[model samples]
Target: MAFQCQRDCYMQEFVTTVVSCCPSELKLENNGKKEKVKGFNVILKDTILFPEGGGQPDDRGTIAGVPVLRVTRQGAEAVHFVSSPLEVGLEVQLKVDWDRRFDHMQQHSGQHLITAMADSMFSYKTTSWELGRQRSTIELDTGTAKPGEIEALERAVNEKIREHVPVTVKVLTLDDPAMEQVRSRGLPEDAVGPIRVIDIEGVDANMCCGTHVSNLSHLQVIKILGIEKGKKNKINLIFLAGNRVLKYAEKSYTIERALTALLKTGADDHVEAVDKVQKSVKALQKSNLSLLRDMAVLIAQNYKNNPNRGNLFCLHRKEGDNEFMNIIANEIGTEETVLFLTVGEEKGAGLFLLVGPEEIVEKMGPRVAELLEGKGAGKKGRFQGKASRMERRGEVEALLQEHSRCPHLEE
Candidate 1:
């Protein structure tokens, strides 16, 4: 027998007897952690909740007041996963989530209309399709769509929707003559009983197990968002139908309003304003780099000119980068003096460089990296790497001071 959902897509409530309830484990994610939740797989005599199949997600609702986490097709049965179990033969009221079910119906039926029109009008074959959370996609066999072809296709699809074409379901045997006319992607090996076909009036006839709306008017409208390059020799057509189109438009408008306020520009000028801001930021970054290089040279020259300055020198710059540190090291000359330089937040993550004698740098590099919660490597007389605990800068300076005092200790 056809499942109650497949039999009547419009049914919202139904009374059914529990055929079986088996103990099962359901995996759930909570706060980014996966947990095995104990549950029961309840099989009913018939169900109004559609199972996961044909690229449509399973329906979510309640069974006997218990939340149904998932519904899956096992062989020819719809198994509803619930936290509580119902006794066999016990009658329970099952309520389908009307909003989710209706949304799915709109998208599924919309796909049929689109598939048929694309094939008839442009010779584009739908190889596969997916009903996503916010939108849906259809993978076409062709690698590219001709200019204006998608726009024309969208017009054709909406025209059918406005026509209020009727959509009906038919159950036929494998040997039925009409079965030869329906488009199919083959049946599952475990598929049992007769095949169910969805007929979109004079538009399309396809063999599908998923539930759909009864009329094209129910689709409200379908908007072809755009196309994306798919796998080899294929293109994915992205679209939203019915309420999804409205929701998408609402969200897009909200974002545009927010951007308009932030950029102090109208919606139509948002792209140009953002581009201008990006160019300005790039120019400022270039100027900042040039200034940092100049400052590095001056700092190194200051240290070199100080005859009374100790061999140990330490400096930290919040805006410094690797290039700045290297410039200072090269200017000051690391042969006779130890240079400890760090760049970034004083109490957060940053970069560090230590340059001096080869032996001293090699021996102190690992120790200093560990103290700053970082790792580094170097040959010759320089060591540098990233550090996470820039607050430990004082401790590093102290260690460098002790090493300078006892120069032979590094030997």
Candidate 2:
């Protein structure tokens, strides 16, 4: 609040008149954090500030050359808060930063164009919209889309952006019922007085409180990211326009440049580089498997004898990456008649099999599993079990040697 303007008597065009009157020599309040501009916040005053309401961000810029950090409506008054201390009653020239303002207008107006296009082309009504820095989104009341239909809608919208339609902003108070014709009756629940409508000229007309450009020409471009389903009958659309498009393009260019150099491929040839990675992965898998096969043969050669035909048992346990050890165990199991336990990283995790003669494997395997604190559920005339701890390795070896002493373990 300006020191000169009383809470009750601040005129409607108060901010413009008062700010112009104050000189830079006026004293500031609160040292700096919050500064009061003499002629700020009055209705109808042409000051550069985005008002806060309707989920839209507050307009930001300098007033009197001092940055107006934010703008909010106190009752009907638009209060402009400036960073640092502002000279009270100081005369300061007001300027609106067009570049930033233009970008916001582009996205906001683009939304109107989209909503209008959707209503006209597909009988869809927009329920809500969000204007973000990188993207904008619109929620519509109906959605049952196929890929082809989506593509067609996308193409239609881009065509409209290229066409460059006209958008108009209209401000109306609640007292005037004529304002009703300007937009729908969906006045916000929080609307204390007038309803501001952003009409896309002859295009879309709706009651919106957010700041928008005066014309659609300012938008310049639009890009749709995707459509997401909202409730049962609604869908949300994600898009970008103007500055957002340029920001996305700049980021994309950076990534493409880095990838081109790293992968040694032209922009169009990135796919070939990706395919090369897949081929390399496949080759590595084959080479690794061959190594496992050779290790299996060495383990098989260590087995003492083939009991009931080709059945053989060899217990070799170690610690490492669980998958690697499991693969080595699998290789050893495949080579011998009845390859037994080859425990690895997962100590309690071991291999079990029964291979040689069907009867011998079926009968002794279960008994061996019971004794070894493991399972031989699968039979190949071999049974594998895990030792509880590293110290249990000796116990397992002793048990294997004792297999000769035990009648059932012999098969």
Candidate 3:
């Protein structure tokens, strides 16, 4: 086995919380740009704070009472940048947010266990692992793993978490003879030092260079978000860890309460409540559609009886959905050449236009369209446009009646 000398890595502490934290190892000397004051991560020889590596988010908390913005690894070193510079050599008692740390542990350890189970059961390997803000995921090498297989693997992994297995962290060199035992050699190429292998005794073993809880009991729960086909032969899994689980629980509770109150139902009666809501919504929609149809008929009947019908009768109004205008035009269009136009439901707003027969449109469609003004235009022997206000209706109707281009064109 290759020995890990302090000189080889320039940074490596075999013991945990043993080395002096280099809070001012500040790499970016004169980065040319200045920072807006405080809040940053730091590097320490033996940091109790886990950095953002191994698909896990970094631990967040106060270092000597100063808030730690984030934790990250610089090469082979684990660093913790704090809000204020801690007294250089002072060994600040590092405190990690247990809730956040534990949640990440569950998701991370859960991923290893599930991946191992998948490999053992279906011979499907885990390609990669990703722990997101709200969810954690492990991509399996194959999509052929059935739902039953997924269920079995999930059950088995959760069972392992429940069993509270011992997570052993063994530091080994690259030249170690025992590398053959590592089933998951998922190591990054740049990790060229004493590799820390976290072995979930009797279950999963993988070469990982990330912070982990001492025991599996720290992981309270492993929630599987869902599995979907990613690429050819690849499956993606999304899941949530630690405090995020509590957040999700709270969110689900809020939604449940709102839904229950809205449906006038109890919390436990969700399915029936949903069914009731669907039925009620459908009934209301039917009633609304019926009312709309009646309104259209009524408007069209009036436009027909108006008696000031002209060949180029354009009945454009901001009444309702497009169906309303079409309905009105269809109703009166059958009796006269009517061109109905408008922008939307707000009456006296938007624009309007109307054109009768091709001959009539050619005669006065352009002139009327010009008078309507404000970015309105029509062509193809049709008067078409939107108006700035509803007052242009008289001008539009007068134009059509005076044009009197083609009476026969009224269809």
RMSD of 2: 13.8
Tell me the tens digit of each residue's lDDT in model 1 across 32-123.
Answer: 99999999999999999999998899999998899999999999899999999789999999999999999999999999899999999999
Per-residue lDDT over 30-89 for candidate 2, one digit per residue giving the tens place of the 0 to 100 score:
755555544333232444455666546666656556666556665545666554455555
Count of clashing pairs, candidate 3: 14
- Model 1 earns a TM-score of 0.88
Ranking by TM-score: 1, 3, 2
Q: Candidate 2 clash total? A: 23
User: Model 1, 135: alpha-carbon shift in Å?
Assistant: 2.1
Distance from true location, Cα of 141 in model 3, Å? 2.7
Quantify all predictions' global Cα lDDT against the true fold: 0.94, 0.59, 0.63
Query: What's the ranking of the predictions by lDDT, best on top?
Result: 1, 3, 2
Per-residue lDDT of model 3, residues 1-411, tens digit only: 122211121122232332443434333324786445444445554555666776777777666666766666666676666557655556655556766666666677667777787787778888788877677778888756675776777677777777888887787776798676776546666566676777888877787755555566666666666788788878897666555667889999999989888878788898987887799999998887778778878976876787875444445444455566556566665533656456443435565555455655566655665665544555654455555556666676665665556355442
**Steric overlap count per candidate:** 0, 23, 14
Runs with alpha carbons beyond 4 Å of true place in candidate 1: 29-38, 84-90, 336-339, 354-383, 398-411
